[model samples]
Target: MLIPALCFVVMITAVMQTAVVPLMPDIATQLGVSPNAVGWIVTANLLTATVCTPLLGRLADRRGPRRVLLCILGVVLVGSLLCVAWDSLPVLVAGRALQGMSFALFPIGVAVLRSALGPHRLTAALGIMSGTMSVGGGAGMIAAGLLYRDGDDYRRVFWLLVVLAVIATALAWFVVPDSPGSGTSSGADFWGVVGLAVGLSALLLALAQGGTWGWVSAPTIGCVVAGALVLAVWYRHERRFDAPMVTPALLTARAVAPAHLAAFLVGIAMFVQFLAIAMFVQVAPEQAGYGFGASVLETSLLYLLPGQVVGITAAGVSGLLVRKFSADRVLMAACAVGVCGFAFVGFAHDRPWQVIVAVAVLNIFVSVAYGALPAMLVEHVAPHDTGVANGINAIARTFGSSLASALVGMLLATITIAGTDIPSERAFVAAFAIGGVTALIAGFTAAASRA
Candidate 1:
C-alpha cells in the first residue's frame, strides 16, 4: 500500500509540473500574452524546482520523509488553491513556485523507499516509481483536456488538484512509517543550504529568462556570475565540513564524477528531446506541427497516451533486464533507443504511425534512464548521504531542464521563417538532428561510465 502511495507522491508532483503543457496556448489566449511569454509558466516552475530540490533533499536527510512529504503536500495543496483564487498570470506564476517545491517528493520518496522497502521489492519498486511520472504526465494531460470540456470546466481541474493534493498530504502523515534518519540531522549547515538555494534559483532564473532579457543583458550576466560565486564558496565550505550538506568528496571521487557527469549529460539530452519532440509532434498546421487538426485537449491526449503506456510496460519488464544484465547496460540501451526515436522524428512525415513508434521508443528509453539512475547512485553512496548525492542527481536533471528550456526556446524563436512566423520544417529538422546527435553522445557516455 505504501509503495503505491509513494509513487502517488511523485506522480502528482509531475502533474503539477506538467499540467500546463496542454494549456500553454490556452493560457496565452486567456491572458492576452504571447505564447513565448507563456512559456515562462513551465520554465518558472522548473527553475524554482531546480534551486530548491537540493535544499529540500538535504532537509529530508535531517528531518525525515514524513515531515518533508507532509510539508510538500501542504505546499502543493495551497498552491492549487492559490491558482484558483488568483487570476493574474504573474500571480499564477507565484502559485507555481509553491507547486515547484512539490518536486521534493521525488528524492524524498526514494529515500523512504530505500529505508523501508525490502531488497526483494527494490528493483521493481524503483522502475514502477519512475513510471508514476509518466502516468502523472499522461493523466494530467488527458484530464486537463477531458476536464476542459469533459462536461466540466478547466476550473474543475484546479479544484480536483486541490482536493487530491490535500488528500495525499493527509494520507502521507498517517500512513508513512516515520522511519530511521528520516528527518533533519544535527548541525544541518543552514548557511550552506540557503546559499545553494539562492544561488541555484538565481542561476536558473538567468538561464530561463535570458532569452527574453537578451543573453548579454547585465541582469543576466550578474545572475550567472552571482550564482557561480555562491556555488564556488559552497564547494569550498563543503570540503572542510564533516557530513557536508552536499557530500563534496563524492563529487570529486575518481569514480563518482564520471558517473555523475554521465547522469548530467543524459539529463540535458533527455529533457531537450522531451520538450522539443512533444511540441514538434503537435506542430500547428501552419508551422508543420502534427497538423492533426486535433483540439488542444485532443492533441494532448495523443501526445501523452503513448508515453504513459510505454512507461508502465517497461516497469513490469524491468526486473527481467536487471536480473540478466547490469543497470548501466539498461541505461545505455535506453539512450540508444531514445536517439533512434529522435532520428525518426526528424524524418516523421505524414505517417501518424511513424510518430507513435518514435514516441513509444523514446518513452521506454526515458523510463529506463531515469528509473535506473538513482539505483546506480545508491549502489555507490553510503545510505545516510544517498539523499544528498541524489540531490546532485536531481540537480543534474534540473540543470538539464534549464538548458533545454533555453535551447529549445531559442531554437524555436530562431527557426521561425522570416516574416511568416511559422517554424520552417527545415529548421525543425535541424533541431531534431541536434537532439538525435546529443542523445547518441549521451548513450556513449552512459555506456562508458564506470558505474
Candidate 2:
C-alpha cells in the first residue's frame, strides 16, 4: 500500500509535466499567444519545479514526508482546478507553476520509503518507484493524444489531472505512515535556499531559452555568467554554514559524486532519444528526405510506448541485478547496453519498427540508471539527508535535460532539408551518435565509482 501510494504520486507528477506537451500549439491558438509565449507554460513550470524541489525536500526532512506530501498534493490539486476554471493564459501559466511543485514529491516520497522499508526490501521498492516516472510520462503523451484530438480546449486534460490528484491524495493519507526522526528541530538555511533558487533559475532559464534567443546573444551570455558567479558564492556559503542545506562534504564524497555524474550524462542521452526520435518519426516523408510521416498518436503508441514499457521492465531487472551484484555494476552494464542501442538507432532508423526497437534499447540503461543512481545515493547518505540529496540529483538530471534540449535544437536546426523546416537525416544520425558517446562516457564513469 505504501509503495503503491508513492508510485501513484510519482506518476501524477510526471504526467503533469508531460501531458501538456502535445497540446501546446492548441493552447497557444486558444489563448491568442505567440508560440514563444506558449512555451512559457513549460518554462514556468520547470523553473518553479527547479527552485521548489530542494526547498520542499528540506521541508520534508524537518516535518514528516506524509505531511509535506499531502500539502504538495493539495497545492497540485488546486492548480489543476485553476486550469480548469480559467481561460486566461497568465492564469493558466500560474496554475502550471503550482503544479510544478509536484517534482519534489518524488524525493520526499523516497525519504518516506527509506524510513519505512528495510534494507532487504528497499532496492526493489525504489526500482518500482523509479519506473513510474517513465510510465507516467508515456501515459501523459498517450492520454493527450487520445483526448482533445483537435481542440483548443485542454481543460479535459486538467480535469483528469484533478481526478488523479484527488485519488492519490486520498490514498496517500491512508497508506503512508509516519516515520521516526522526522520532526527535526534544525532550521533551514535561508541564504542557501535563496542562492540556489536564484542561481538555478538564471541558469536553467538561459538553457531553456538559449535556442529561441540565440545561444550567443547578450542575454544568454549574461545569464550564464551571473548564474555561475551566484552558484560559486552559494557553494562557499554552504561550506561555511554550521548546518547547511546540502553538505558539501557529502556531495564531494567519492561514493556519492559518481552517481550525480552518471545521472547528468544519462539525462542528456535519454533526452536525445525522447526529443529527437519524436521529431524524426513525425516528419512527413514527402516533405522531408526521411521520416515515417507518423502522426502524434502513432509516434506515441508505436515508438515511445514500447520504450516506456521496456523501461519499466528494465527497472525490475536492474533491481534484481543490484541484489545480486552492486548498483554501480548494474549502472555500468546498463549504460554499455545503451551505447549499443544508440548506435543501432543511428544506423538503422529508416523503418518505424526499427525506431521502436531503438526506443526500447535506449530505455534499458535510462531506466536502470534512474533506479540505481538513487539507490546508490540512498545507501551512502543518512536518513536525514535523503530528500535533499535526491533533490540535488533530480536537479542535476533536470539540468542535463535542459542542456540536451538546447543541443538537439541546434543539431536539428543546423541542416534542414532544402527549404523545408524539416531536419535532414544526417542531423538525426549525428544526434544518436552523440547519445551513444555520452552513454559510453557515463558507463565508464559509473564503473570507476568507488561505490
Candidate 3:
C-alpha cells in the first residue's frame, strides 16, 4: 500500500520531463519561436531540477519529507497554472523551471523510505523508486501525446497534472509515516550549496546554449570550463568542511564510488538508447525500409513495453533478487540484459515489434540497477548524505543526457551507409551500438564493486 502510494508521488516528479514532447510543436507554434529552441523546453526543466535536487533532498533530511513534498507540490501547482495563464514563451520557460523544482521529490522520498520502511520491504521499495525516474518519464510522454491531439489538448494535460498533484499532496500529508532522522541535520551547508548551484548553472547553460553558441565557440568553452572548475573546487571544499553537501569520504568509498560511476555510465548509455530507439521505429524516411508514418500517439504505442510497468515491478523484483542474489550480481545481470537489448536494434531494421522487445529488456535492467543503487549508497554513508549523493547522480544524468543529444545530432549528420544517405534507422543503430558498449562496461563495473 505504502509502496504504491510512493510510486505515484515519484511519478509526479518526473511528469514534466516527458509529458511536454507532443505539445512542443504546438507550444513553439503558439509562442512564435523556432522548434530548435524546443530543446529549452527540456533543458530548462532539467537545469533547474539538477540544481534544486540536493537542496530539496537535504531539506527533507532536516524537516521531514512531508513538508518538503508539500512545498514542491505547491511549486508545481503554481508552474502549471502559470503556463496555462501566461502567453509568453519566457513565462512558460519560467513555469517550467518551477516544475523542475519538483524533480527532487522522488529522490527525497527514497531517502525518507530508507530511513523508515521495514527491512523486508526496503529493497523492493528502493528499486521501484529508482525505476520511477525512467518509468515516470515514459508515462509522462505517453500521457502528453495522448492528450495533445489538438490545441485544447494542452489545457487537458495541465488540468490532469493539477488533479494528480492535489491527490499526491494529500497522500504525502496523510498516508506516510513521519520520516525518522528528519531532524538529524543542522543548518544549511552554505558554500557547498552555492558551489553546486553555480557549477550546475554554468554547465547546463553551456549545454543548452551550445546548440546556439557552437560547442567550441569562445562563450561556450568558457561556460563549460567555468562549470568544471566550480565543481572541482566544490568537491575539494566539501572534503574539508564540517557539514559537506556530499561527504568526500562517501565519494571515495569502495562501495559508493562504484555506484556513482555506474550511475553516470547508465545515464550516458540509457538516454541515448531511449532517443535512438524511439526515432528508429517512427521516422518516415527514404534511407530506411518499412518506414511507418506513425502519428505521435501511434509511435508511442510501438515502444510501450516495461518502462512504465517497471515503475511498479522493480520494487517487487529487487526484494526477491536481493534475498537470494547479491545486489551487485543482480545489477550486473540487469545491465548485461540492457546491453543485449540495445544490440538487438542492429538487427531490427524492418521490424517494429523487435524494437518493443529491446525496450522491455533495457527497462528491466534499468529497474533492477536503479533500485539497488540508492540502497547500496545509503549502506555506505550516514543518512544525511543521501540528498547530495543522489544530487550528484542527478547531475551526472543531466550531463550524460546533454552529451547524448549532442552526439546523436552529430551522428545523424555524419554517418551514411551507401551512396544513398543512411536513414534515421541506421543512425539509431549507431547510437544503440554505443549504448550497448557503454552498458556492457557498466555491467562489469557494477559486478566488480566491493559491495
- Tens digits of per-residue lDDT, candidate 1, 107-210, equal 78888887887756776677677656545665676677777763343456777678779878876877788866744464567777777777787888788889
Score each candidate by Cα lDDT: 0.72, 0.84, 0.73
- Backbone clash tally for model 2? 0
Please name the candidate that would achieve the greatest lDDT relative to the true structure: 2
| Candidate 3 clashes between residue pairs 3 or more apart in a chain or in different chains | 124-315, 127-371
- Candidate 3 per-residue lDDT, tens place, 284-305, comes to 6554554565666766665754
- The Cα error of candidate 1 at residue 411, in Å, is 1.3
TM-score between model 3 and native: 0.92
Candidate 1 Cα outliers beyond 4 Å, as residue runs: 28-40, 149-154, 182-188, 284-291
User: Residue 422: error of model 2 in Å?
Assistant: 1.7
TM-score winner among the candidates? 2
Please give, for residues 1-451, the per-residue lDDT of candidate 2 as tens digits: 8887888888887788778888888888888899888898889888989999887887888777888888999999888888889898988889899998998988898899998999888888888787677567767877777676775477888888899889988998899998654575546688988898999999999998888888999999999999999999999999999878777865678878888888889888887888889889988888776898878788788888888888888877776777778788888888899999999989898888898998888888788888788888887988888888888788777888778888898999987778776788999898999889889998999878853
Name the lDDT value of residue 5 in candidate 3: 78
Ranking by lDDT: 2, 3, 1
Ranked by lDDT, the better of candidates 2 and 3 is 2
Q: Which stretches in model 2 have alpha-carbon errors above 4 Å? A: 186-188
